[model samples]
Every structure is written in C-alpha cells, then in structure tokens.
Target: MATIDLTSDAFEKTVTADGIVMVDFWAEWCGPCKAFGPVYEAASEKNPDITFAKIDTEAQQEIAGALEIRSIPTLMIFRDGIQLFSQPGALPGHALDDLIDQVKAIDMDEVRAEIAKQTDEPSDAD
Candidate 1:
C-alpha cells in the first residue's frame, strides 16, 4: 500500500502487472511535483488494491525519456496491462479519487473490442 520508487528496470514489470497501477512521473525540483506527492501518497494508502509507484525524472532519465514525460507530474494508469490513461499535471485528491473511480468503472470488454477493431482496421496507405 505504500508508494514505491520506480527505476527503469522496475517500470515494465510494474505496469504490466495484473491489476491497476498508478505511476507518478516526478522530479524533486518541480514545485507541482512536490505539492502532489502527499496527495498521491494518501491515495496509495486508501487504495491498497492499486500499485502506486513514482519515477524520479532526474534519476530515471532513460525511463522518463522513453515515456516522453514533458512535465513534472505526469499521471499514468494501467489496468490489466493496458494503459487506459495518461495525463500531464497534478490532480487534487478529490479529482484523483474521481478519476480512480472512473477508471475502475470502465467496461474493459468494450475497451478491448474497440482496441481490436482499431487494430483490425485497414490502413489508408493503400
């Protein structure tokens, strides 16, 4: 239930885990990132079922670059190995909680069908 620091090696396995994973991409020098830290931590304790991880942008340059984290506080949510949400900014505790609720309520079966449809669609290059 405690928030874990994520390194490049831990990133993949953490996100690809079987359940909800919330990752906060942040840096110590960032004001917003600092402000959001406690809020994120509080949520982590409340939502024990979700894996809460933080990636320090300064230390984990490779992982930050790979993810194209242009901002200090980027929030990403992964469920069942599918990245359902990615947003750049700090979220208030209430808003973050609301988002978690929304993500949990998603119809993954429809989402999977939509992904399949998009993948199966022919390209326009022809």
Candidate 2:
C-alpha cells in the first residue's frame, strides 16, 4: 500500500483503527524529512498490511501540536489502537524493516494487560 497524507480530521480515526498504523511526522522544509520520505514510502509498499500515513507539520500544525511533536521526521507506530513505538530520526531501510518485524512480534494481550495495570495503579499525586 502507498503512504497516505493524514490531516487533523482524519488523524484520530486512522490511528485508533485496528491493525498496525505507522505515522511519519514531517515538514517540507526539513532536510531529514526529505531524506526519509522515500524510505518511508518504500516501507509502506513493502508492508501492505500496515497503514502508513504522514502528517506534514507545516500544513497540519494542529495535529503536530496535539501530539507534542517537536522534531521533524518523527515516527510513531500504533497497533490495535495502542501506540507501540515513537522516536525521532530517520531510520535506515534495514532498521525500519527490523522495527516492523519487532512490532509484528509483539503480543498485544501482554501489552493490553500492562496498560491495564498502569491505569489501575494509584497515582503518586494521590
């Protein structure tokens, strides 16, 4: 599948859907973002099962601000509506492939349980 452009209106629905969703936060003016574009697009084609999307920081400032994105070419991965990975920098093709493998290997049952535990715990503020 090809990468899709994500806008503010579609951001929440797209990321919260089932299956794996990879989001690339980028800007037109950023050198790193330009360099990473092709890498990300190629990965999208390689991983047809995953939803690969991009948010142009310059055009989608609202979404960027809401996500607290401070850097260009920030990559975030979500699986079954749960975010699994987020980091700055452009990943090499090999590293991106490795990351996809790791995300696929994750046991979401364990992840959900962990989330439940954290949410159930008493807060330090209390």
Candidate 3:
C-alpha cells in the first residue's frame, strides 16, 4: 500500500479521530527512515482495515512538534482517538507486522478499566 501523505493541518482528522491509524514519523534524509519505508508500506498493504500515514518531519514540522517526535522513523499508533503506542527506530518487516497484530488483539474493555483506575484515584490530601 502507498503511504498516506499526512500534513500538519490534517493530523487530527487523519490520525486522531480515525480508527486504528498508524503514523510513521520520518524524514527524507534519514537513512533509517529510508530503510523502514518498505516495511511500513508492506504492513499497510496487509492491513487495509487500518489507516497508515506518514508525516515528513522536515515538511510537517508542526505535526512533529505536536507529537514530540524526537527521533526519525518513529511509529505512533492511535486507536479511536487515543494514542496506544509510540516508539522510535526502524523495525523489521516481521516486527512491524507483529506490532500491528498485538495492537489489534488488545482487549478494549481492559484498556478502559485501566483508564478508569487511573481516573478514579482519590486525592492524597485526605
């Protein structure tokens, strides 16, 4: 599958609100980014149900800044408006595939339970 060109203005709609959107933060001059390109594309093709996008750090500085993308070829996974994972460095084809599979297998009910636990904590002053 071809990489979706993501711009600063389109980040929210494309990745945030979209279901299971994976954004690859990279730059044209980064060697690791170039190496990971094919792996990212192949995974995208294999998973049509998920949206895959790429944000060029050089071209989309604002988006990169907002996401605090400090390294090239960072992969950020956002599911249903929540950021599930963000990692830097290049991943092998199989590794990338495994990452996607793991994310898809996550139990959303458990995820929500964890979120509730964090939010339900009482103040310490009491």
Candidate 4:
C-alpha cells in the first residue's frame, strides 16, 4: 500500500486504530527526508498489512509540535494504539526492514503488562 498523508485532524484517529501504523515525519527541504522517502514507500509496498502514513512537517506543524519532533525524517511505529518505537534520522532499507521485523516480533501482551505495572506504581513525586 502506498503511504497516506496525515494532517492534525486525522493524526489521532489513524495512529489510534488497530494494527501497526508507521508514521514518517518529514519536510520537503530536508535532504535526508528526501532520501528516506523512497525507502519508506518501498516498505509500505512490502508490508501491505501495515498502515504507512506521512506527516509533512511543514504543512502539519501542529502535529509535529505535539509529537515533539525536533528532527526531520523521524520515524514512529504504533501498534494497537500504543507507540512501540520512535527514532530520529533516516534509516537505510535494510535497517528499516530489521526494525519492521523487530516491531512484528514484539509481544504486546507483555508490553501492556509493563505499562500497567508502571501506571499502578506510586510516583516518586507523590
């Protein structure tokens, strides 16, 4: 599947949807973002089951700000409404593939449990 462009209006709904979603935050003026665009597109074709979405930082500044994206070509992976991975910098094709594999291999049940435990624990500030 080809990547879909995301705006602030759609960002929440798209990332919160079930299944895996890969969001690429980029800008037209960034060289690395240009280089990584094709790699991201290729991965989308290869992984048809996943949702590949792009947020043009120039056009969607609000969303970028909300996500605290300080760099172009930032990649974020979300699964089952939870963020599993977030990193800045462009990834090569092989690295992107490896990342997809790692995300796929994650045991979400364990992740949920870990989140639950953290939330249940009392905060040091309390």
Those runs of model 1 whose alpha carbons end farther than 4 Å from true positions after fitting are none
Which candidate leads the pack in lDDT?
4
Candidate 2 collision pairs: none
The TM-score of candidate 1 is 0.95
Q: CA lDDT, every prediction?
A: 0.93, 0.94, 0.89, 0.96
Choose the strongest candidate by TM-score.
4
**Per-model TM-score on C-alpha atoms:** 0.95, 0.95, 0.91, 0.96
lDDT of 2 by residue, 1-126 (tens): 499999989998999999999999999899999999999999999999999999999999988898899988999999999999999999999999999999999999999999999999999897
Q: Check candidate 3 and list the clashing pairs.
A: none
TM-score of 3: 0.91
For candidate 1, lDDT tens digit of each residue in 26-66? 99899999999999999999999899999999999999899
Candidate 1: lDDT of 112? 88
Candidate 2 Cα RMSD after full superposition onto the native fold (Å): 1.2
Q: Give the clashing residue pairs of candidate 1, or none.
A: none
In candidate 4, stretches whose alpha carbon ends up further than 4 angstroms from where it belongs are none
Candidate 2 runs further than 4 Å off: 124-126
> How high is the lDDT of residue 5 in model 3?
92
